[model samples]
Target chain A: MSVNISKPSFQPYTGEKARISRAFDYLILVLALFLFIGSFHLHFALTVGDWDFWVDWKDRQWWPLVTPLMGITFPAAVQAVLWEKFRLPFGATLCVTALLIGTWVARIFAYHLWNYFPINMVLPATMLPGALVLDVILMLSNSLTVTAIFGGAAFALLFYPSNWPIFGMFHVPVEYGNGQLTVADLFGFEYIRTGMPEYLRIIERGTLRTYGQYATPLSAFCSALLCSLMYTLWWYIGKWFATVRYLNKI
Target chain B: MATTSEQLPVSLESDSKIPWYLQDLPLYLKGFGILTVIYIGLRLYQGAFAVASGLDSSEPAFEQYWMQLFYVELAVIAVFVTSVWGYLWFSRDRNLDQLSPKDEIRRYFTLTMWISIYTFAVYWAGSYFAEQDNSWHQVAIRDTPFTANHIIEFYFNFPLYIILGGSAWLYARTRLPLYAKGISLPLTLAVVGPFMILVSVGFNEWGHTFWFREEFFAAPIHWGFVIGVWFALGVGGILLQAVSRLIELLDMLEEAP
Candidate 1:
């Protein structure tokens, strides 16, 4: 009598295994959406909070400089994991999109509906264009150094121009009360926020005022320099946090 | 032939019908639905009472409208943390060493759902209501730490997410063999790091005592919360760990006929 036996062979996941993997992917997608929205928004709101909160705060100097400097952080960190491990390159886009969604929801519910603040006053600036460029640079070059220098620079430089259309009209000089003030300033004045006196508003302050129209460009470039360093640092931070090692004890 | 189960003595049901791997999906969907209703209900409550009664914490109306709700929230949190955490702990698998590959894979799926739910809660605390705190502060003076938004955001939302995150941590540590043998670093970071956000609330309210009027969202005083949220990035590490383990488990199973 002869006995027939089958051997176990390793094969690529198919059918049920493939389905299970896809299900896990979907689950991760949901988890990632909330994760990015919650974590990134909190970070952005705290670090670059006021600048992103009000249109009047969207000044040429601080707004353009600080927004990208802070905004590049989560994207760079997320890209470090998504790109390096999974070879997915949409990390920057994902973070920016999540932040946008979160800010929009807050602006609508928190500011507009709750406090009756005009939507225009609480409009959030977009970093989508710059985020796209960051992702593309990382995808194409696949080198951290190259992505940091060029991609980080592009992220900062694009902030002002991309948001120019939404806010450029607000910056148009208007003669109000025999003093020169922009429409954004007028909005700030009309809507009196508690504890936020005119003096507290940090906009266009410094010797950079001597440069006049050149201040924005100067700030953008300075931000670009800082963002490059910030991106590199956060990339490492992402990698550090993404460690798969298990400890014997915490 | 696939590797036979030697460690685990748990027997599969000898029925013609094959069991679905994602058996816990329905429960996950129900969890999402319940959480949505609860969050939306809280937001609606804020909308109704915030402007009228929330501006003055010292008043009788404030006590009735806000403080009562605060007390109720505290009660709910206490009951919730105890029940859910106790259930997860008490129901932990004693024979994790003998867990079948299929059962382990299913546990991973369940673990993901727990984390996904936790992140959903984080969305409310960190994103929606956190920014709304600024809007509320702009309109209403922060005379006390237990302002309208703080009643919901800091006290309720923070603790709720912390509980859910703790639930996920406990679920993994108790059920999964690998997690049982060695504590997962990324998992701990993701859970414990966010728990510190609750601690930061004390520091934050204390800092606000000096300048209770100004609502500078990005000020250095708020940096503690920022530092706390960054640990959420450890989800990336958790993903790496889960994916590698799942791959190994999937390889050990026989192909579906």
Candidate 2:
């Protein structure tokens, strides 16, 4: 019989370093505390259709573009802290994982477990794999600016395809009461009963063949571009957060 | 039958001036014990109530039963405060420099357990409860952003995780010597990214009020949240590095003959 026992190694540190570390720790703590509190209420609002309740503007063109842009802030700031200071390659991955886990878990509990809504009708936004891919690319490159330029573009470009597998089924065309509309149109038809009329869907009808029936390509391109721009700005933010020396300290 | 004293190792019974209890008392009797007991008890009580109420099919219990659960959760948090303070007080003497190899290992295990519990508690608060009502699905009309679901999800759940994420960072920074010297970027990302997302929840809620009445994949109002979500990648990088360093430290310790 073999007994596997391990000893622990303890490192000594100076009091000054400890104090500085404590200050950083407090800053991190303050930020984390804010995140924990904010996500709870945000999920509820999204579920209840508070922020995303406008039907007229809810088109493929703008929705995907904006959601990712807003979401990019965390990853950018986090990356600043991780990449610049710690040379950690998984900042995006961790943040994405937490968000996906939190979002999906919330959706499942709210929709399935809590009977908040039918899963088929309303699902949580899917962005985890894209986040993972971005992190992997950043890890391989080890360059924040390059990652921002390429990874950000990739993040946007990948959104449609990543979500297409799920949302594609809803993209199919359907005729409701003689009005030929895509499944996306019927989404608003069944849910989202606001002041906006039903005829406002940005889909191609039999009479109008100007734009193709699909809008995903254009939407994805715009999203990718926006993501690229966001990535560039956020890279700087990441660097800022990684800054160890404070003005007061100087 | 020979000398029983010969069985003892030279280091085992050799006494320094410091009393053993004084050396290790902080390790075990930290206030965390009582807090843990109270939190567990409250959680159990809430779970039991939910089960019992769910079993009944007769009454149309109020629509906001889920919201009521928040109070029970608050009670659990109150208990956590006690636990944290208690642990801090009891572990004062067991600082990193003073601990023996055995005690150091024990403290690491204890810290891991505390963090794990904290993580679980955060998930429950930030994700689980916010989605409880399903009030949005039930309603036929789209009202203000503060409709009950938004209130719970944006205002309630998002903040809870931010708090947890921040506390976790604080814990690693203040208490652990390894994390004290150099800033752990991944840990910072992990904490900070989530916090930004939490703030974006407000923008997300307000956006829905002005526009985005329907599910559009791309909306300018939602751009803020998408940007926030993207930051998670940076955070992921940092977490991997931190964990790797921890593992390396562990391995180094284990390799020493």
> Using TM-score as the measure, which candidate wins?
1
Error of 2 at A220 (Å): 3.0
In order of the candidates, what TM-score does chain B achieve? 0.93, 0.53
- Give Cα-based local distance difference scores for all models: 0.94, 0.51
Question: For candidate 2 chain B, which ten residues in a row score worst on lDDT?
Answer: B54-63
What is the per-residue lDDT of model 1 for residues A108-147, given as tens digits with 9 covering 90 to 100? Answer: 9999998999999999999999999999999999999999
Clash count in backbone of candidate 1? 1
TM-score of each: 0.94, 0.56
Q: Candidate 2: list runs displaced more than 4 Å.
A: A1-58, A71-101, A128-141, A191-216, A242-250, B1-76, B86-91, B94-116, B131-257
Off by over 4 Å in 1: A1-12, B1-19
- Pairs clashing in candidate 1? A8-B1
lDDT of 2 by residue, A172-211 (tens): 7788999997765665567543434455343333432335
Per-model i-RMS: 0.9, 9.6
User: Each model's DockQ?
Assistant: 0.70, 0.10
Clashes of each: 1, 104
Chain B TM-score of candidate number 1: 0.93
**Top-scoring candidate (DockQ):** 1
Q: Which ten residues in a row have the lowest lDDT in candidate 1 chain B?
A: B7-16
Which CAPRI tier for candidate 1? medium
